[model samples]
Target: MDEGINSSTPAWLTEEFIEAILREDEKTQHLQVARADVQPAVAKGDNFGGLLHRVTAEIYYQNNGNNQEKSELRCIIVKSLPSDDWYREVLDQAGVFKREMRMYKVILPAMYKLLKEKLPGVTIPALTARTYTSSITNETLVLEDLRPLGYRMVDRRQQLDLEHCVVALRALAQFHALSVALNDRDPSLMDHFREGFYTPERRHILSPFLQPTLDTLASAVEKWPEYERFGDKIRQIAATSVDRIIDVVKPKNNSLCVLNHGDFWINNILFRYHPKNGKVLGAKFVDFQVSRYSSPALDLQYFIYTSAKEDVRDKSLRHLLQEYHASLTHTLQLLGCGKYAITFGELEQEMKERAFFGLITACTYLGAVLADPSEVVDLDSNFGEESRKNGGQSPMEKAYAGERFRKIFRKFLIHFENEGLL
Candidate 1:
């Protein structure tokens, strides 16, 4: 509470806005949010990951309408577009900023309402969000900060261990399950979500960044004996990556095209651990900037390839699939949906078929994942003018190269090849 609530507040987070929300409740009539302190929430490695800032508020009041005074603290996180014109344009074209606002304001709330009505006890974490879109190019997302609940991110610089993987998968399954039941209750419930994100506008913006990474990755692997066998296929996959992602976005064979957390990488997940033993107790997701309606397998593949190392993935892949399917089915049934038409086999088939989803994403992002926090390049800087000029390679592309990368990339590719994805 001692932190200064100064004039440094961002334009989007005004005192009137904060007071209106705080006093919206009757109990707050006896109190006032005197001031709000804004703090930087950016991690060292994520200087520009989501352009988020934290707002902490101090509330003051008199007890029993008397002279006795009291105070309390409240906090929320704000996500806004980067200050860069280029970054703002990219996010607007891709509808990334708007899509995330929709996710928090529309999709997540709707899904929660459906679950509450259909299944009594079954629930997931609740997200409290308010959005301010000042213009088409300027947007902000104020979300419930999970840190107050002792939730912390599992290290992204290293692969997740078994407990972390299991907790994340089970939690994701619960979320996916909510989508399943909601969709079954109303087949068109997710029609808006199905808009999909790989539009031509997005592709045009993303291609520059993607192409350079692929070329750099290809160049790095060409000399490595481990990837030499699959280098052409790898390069080909990289070159045509965007189109492949777009093609498979359309649902097939009665797949609900379940709501997918389009970016399910470690950076977007948080866990609350038991204080004494330090074991994971709860998990939740953040950053719906890329959420869309697509085959649930897209999320599954993305999560596995991005988070787990070789052994955990190799030995426990199917088991993880089973756990997810079980949670999904259990949730669907709880909503009184009949005859789970989507079976474990169907999910497995999709996983096998969409193996490249994870392969490409992991190959593209793993380097960034493993990078040293201090050495990590800012997102805007990483994809800045220099990269656009040099055919898409940035310091990020350089980070994506080297021995550690080759080892992890080789394992993922070899696994995909054995599974016939190559």
Candidate 2:
């Protein structure tokens, strides 16, 4: 369909109008009209009675007037941009949504093909079409709506059980296997495919944004003497290590590269259940805006640190690492990429280096993200206000976030000390 309607144009236009503008020869009887409507879905903020945005739609399909078939219609709960400026800023910071849509058009098709061939039982969304328009600030992806299929990510407050973790780990391993196999068979093609993923512009934007947060976080920590002991160390680490975190951890070299869902947090994954018994059947990965080529360890570390609870992390860190390594090894063997992929020891080393990357990022940003509504900055205000109000987050929340990172930092330090990997 022609998505060239002007930004000022009224959202509602007849199907004939759209069809004529697009100049499609399809019969009017077969054309479907999709309209956008806003509905309450999920709250975007943590405050009591905070405002949130979600996309809801009424879909109409043209069929014989006499025939009564339940209209194929659905409502999807999308995480909407808070404002037009926010939408524009995200596109400007990341590239335009069109660029991402094009990238997904290529990679997702390949991933779907590989999954269908190698793992027939696994279910994922079938991509129908994608469209980007001025009215839709980001981009609207039209795919088989998987929500009605009963898929959802586990809640953030809850930890996935060992069985669920195993399933997720194995699925991720298989995904990495396909990536490695593709890269091995046609190195140039894979390289070409990844060329569209990372642009220098994005790296430049991320570095500066992270640096300011690092500075603000440093200033904020000094207020608490108990935590102030680590202030200089944290600042030094943030200043000197951010580049290494981005560069070494996210190197574009072919040998170390795989397709990573850059935002690997739990919310982006959806789980479905068996219809007959209402038992969990499988999970499907979503949200490809940050999908790109990077060390697979980047995703592995992100998932573990962000999704696992403190107790789970303390008890299962080593075992979880081992399980990931073993699953990856087996999947690589199945895909015949084991010959070219890294060994478990090598993977462990990469994990150690990359694990710190996530810790630093979490310390610098997570508290601001997760603080209670009463403790957060005004969404409409400038960064100056944001920094001053909560100093980016509540003192308690920031301390908790810092403590979490301190634990991770000590773990890495001990690993390096004992193994002499430093």
Candidate 3:
């Protein structure tokens, strides 16, 4: 498929449409659009996890104000539904595209208003991208382009280090805390966000990816002498993963539930750094297509298992949890929901109760996370035409057969086996 902003670009992306949005954004009615350039934002290999087509539009407009003489350029990212019929149908059935639009339009704005009203002077860092506008009919989203603002996505193949992981955890904690506060104030705030990735209705969309990956993990583990004993356990989990994985989203304790960035991983987060010393400054999240209302543990474990380095996940996990809890408590205190804040012990209990989620992430997502650049196949190509023809193994399934994937899957299987979750 042509993944560029060329002749096939949407009809609504005309100069007149760009001019209207720009005029509203600048609050200048007289601004006139000279021209606009729209191009693909991410490179080929970087779009592995994305369900939407992404493009960046550099809008050149003449500002009618006194100080601005030349045309000022504004850059924004546009995300739209895939043009492929099969993929688009699956996303439509799952309702992820609409869920993301509502998240940016209604839910997140409410949370932002709550924060501003509750804490007038304190500046809480941003949790995600700033949405400019979105359309349910067009299946498009216009958002602030963070690239010009110095935020960049880390290489997916590289394991996230301690500093980046901490930043992500802190942001997630704030997100969870704020969602909890908003839900407490108005319970219906998340009524529309009821379905998650593992919802029964979504199985048709996910199983083609999930079942194959799990079976690949089972086949890969059976080859390892040390891990050979757990092959049956892995197969057992694969057999019932679709039905069992839903447990991750169900609220065992209703009081602790919050909104989850369901697809939280390296690809979905962007981080800003100091130019001089390369120190991490802040991070922002993106891609809420699979955002769900659930226990925060699912997001926490999904991120750590799919993104963090081995040492970080093995040794410093507790420290990371403490950091997340500290931020969560502080944010709750700021939002005047201190009484609802859970203790660290309670947070630990939450993780323990949802331990199966970590295993689910390992089987389904870890291969893509560790996939070599050469293994990056277009989602539609992999899951649509090629998938129907070649039922043997996908590039992603072959990624599971790699040694790195084997070692990581072994470790997770052992952990889950010890915990009796498998």
lDDT values for all models: 0.71, 0.53, 0.77
Candidate 3 deviant stretches above 4 angstroms: 1-17, 23-30, 48-68, 134-137, 204-208, 389-392
The deviation in Å at residue 263 for candidate 1 is: 1.2
Pairs of colliding residues, candidate 1: none
Worst 10 residues of 1 by lDDT: 128-137
lDDT of 1 by residue, 1-422 (tens): 22544344456566666655556533355666777877777565653435677878777775686632667887777677876567777767667776777777667777789878876786556532334322223366666677887887877767788888888888887787777766767766576666446665468765766766776777767778756767676777777888787666667766646778888878788888999999988787888877777788989888887787668887988888888888777767776764644788888888877777777777677777777754465666655666456655365655665556667777777777886766
Using all chains and alpha carbons, the TM-scores for the candidates as numbered come to: 0.86, 0.71, 0.89
Clash pairs for candidate 2: 151-271, 152-271
Give residue 266's lDDT in candidate 3 (0 to 100).
Answer: 90
A best-first ranking of the candidates according to their TM-score comes to 3, 1, 2
Who wins the lDDT comparison? 3
Cα shift from native, residue 94, model 1 (Å):
1.8
- Report the lDDT tens digits of candidate 3 across residue range 1-422: 13334664666666666666667766666777555676666765565433333344334434455434555667777777875666777777778888888888888899998998898887877677888752223476778888889999998878799999999899888999899889989999788777655787777767776776677677777788877777777778777787878766787654588899888899889999999999999999988888888888889989989999988988999999999999999988888888888889999998987888888877777887777756554566666765667763465666776667677777777778888977
